[model samples]
Target: MYAIVRTGGKQYQVATGDTLRVEKLKGEVGETVELSDVLLVADGENIRVGVPAVEGAKVVAKIVEQGKAKKVLVFKKKKRKGYRVMRGHRQMFTALSIQEIM
Candidate 1:
């Protein structure tokens, strides 16, 4: 079975044992996080959806790691003015493994 969960103002489609990174959450490694904003659940041909979120549906995940993403560079230049700007940024994220969906 698979489920669509909402976390950190984002939605994700996940299944049991799936590992993925999401926006930074408040927890340490090996911590259990219960994602309660389940938007949809699917099993074979049967599907359950919610108006905003599925009631009584939740996904359990375990934080495996926490880190930042690869650095991204932002460059800006003004032609004929010799003006230039460069910046780099790395977004923080947490890796979680889906343990169960209920």
Candidate 2:
């Protein structure tokens, strides 16, 4: 079965054994987290969509990694003014392994 769940202010389509990275979540690796904001679920030919979220539907996942993504550079300059600014940032993320959809 597959499920559409919301967590960390984002939505993800997931199925059992699938892994994905999302906004950083609390807790350590190997910890289990339940995504209760399930927007949809599909099992074979059966599909269900929620009005906001499905009650009693949830996606369980395990935290696999907590890390930062690759750095992104931001540069700004003004023509003929010799004014320039540069900045770099790395967004934190959490890798999750979907265990089950219930």
lDDT of each: 0.97, 0.94
Which digits, one per residue and each the tens of the lDDT, describe model 1 over residues 1-102?
999999888999999999999999999999999999999999999999999999999999999999999999999999999999999999999999999999
Once fitted onto the true fold, the runs of candidate 2 whose alpha carbons sit more than 4 angstroms away are: none
What CA root-mean-square deviation does each model show from the true structure? 0.8, 0.8
**Per-residue lDDT tens digits of candidate 2, residues 1-102?**
899998888889999999999999898999999888999999999999999999899888999999999999999999999999999999999999999999
- In model 2, pairs of residues that clash are none
The reply for model 1, stretches above 4 Å from the true place, is none
Give Cα distance to truth, residue 90, candidate 1, Å. Answer: 0.6
**Best candidate, lDDT-wise?**
1
